[model samples]
Target: MTAPPATPTVAVRLVPGPGAERVRVLAERAGLRCGGDEIGPAATVTVIVAADADQALRAQRTRGPLLFVCDTVSPEGRRRALRAGAVVVGAAELTEAGLLEAVLRAAHPHPSIPYPELSGVLSTGTRPGGPPAACTPALTARQTQVLRLMAEGHANADIALLLGCSEHTVKNVIYELMTRLQARNRAHAVAHAVRHGLV
Candidate 1:
């Protein structure tokens, strides 16, 4: 008789906190075998739940596929993760199934966004309109301003202050822009804008 396929083991290297406990439960629910803090050869993917990107970078010393989860990361933090070849998934978008998929994706290794809102980033390069335009969609005047500020690596709060709007408004604008451009995050949106010469 043929043997059943082996379930891949993921290393949950989260700091001691409620987040760590939650990840453990999620891993079990996903039917993924999870290992302890020590990430060695046995681990197919190392899942790190960090409070911020700095913590994620610190945990990235382990040599293997890594899935980094954090609340939010700065532009520099994103660059560091990209340089380290670690996949970053926002904590808000992470789930049991998502975690499992992320682990599998880490094994394959590709630049893709895990969030549903920006999932099209890697697949579609054209604007939302019917025909493929010479350039990406033309950003509205407000979006242009926001994109410029974002390209400058300004945080949401700082952008809001500069634009005379609330932080929430800045965040909403960014979300909309990401959805329109299929951008993974703030840094990605800025990159897309720059690539398409919109910024």
Candidate 2:
């Protein structure tokens, strides 16, 4: 039988600017080829520019699976970037390893939101105004229950017991949640869910 073709690799786009050198170094360290030209059909794009709000806005419009690295981005700036299509945003201080990991995540999101500690559990019932800020359509009732338990500091076993399900089932749910949220890890998934009111 013929073997299947290799999947296309994610292309990396490096935004132009004084900080471009640093981005280049990071990309090299990660073994990712640098596309010195404008954004094209790359699976991932990284924008390195002066730490300015306007630059952040421009970077946000580049393409899918985008990452913006700079000194600091305001909350509004982050929101704008997210709205524009950036999957990750951080300061230049973020380590090359961290940036590489973030790129991998943007390329292949996790399967579920990280479970929160039991102490952090919050009510999932709809609030007076509407649904709790962190509940998204992507999350099933079981996944939400698992997330709530995680927030409360419950481990997978504990969550399984609380929900009367198998530990393996709980793990699967968490995986699904992380993937649907496009989170890199449990913490990021939880934060993303909370930020978007899709927990």
Q: How many backbone clashes does every candidate have?
A: 0, 30
- Candidate 2 structure quality by residue, lDDT tens digits, 1-199: 2222222475477777777787677666666656755445656555555585447665454445666675765544544444444544455556666666556655653312223211222343332222343554457888878876776667899999999999999999999998898766666666565545454
The number of the candidate with the highest TM-score is 2
Q: How many pairs of residues in model 1 come into backbone collision?
A: 0
TM-score of each: 0.48, 0.52
Give candidate 2's error at residue 31 in angstroms: 1.7
Local distance difference test scores for all models: 0.64, 0.59
Q: Please provide, for model 1 over 15-65, each residue's C-alpha lDDT reduced to its tens digit, 9 standing for 90 to 100.
A: 444377787677777776666555455546777888776788786656777
Candidate 2, residue 163: Cα displacement in angstroms equals 11
Poorest lDDT segment (10 consecutive residues) of candidate 1: 122-131
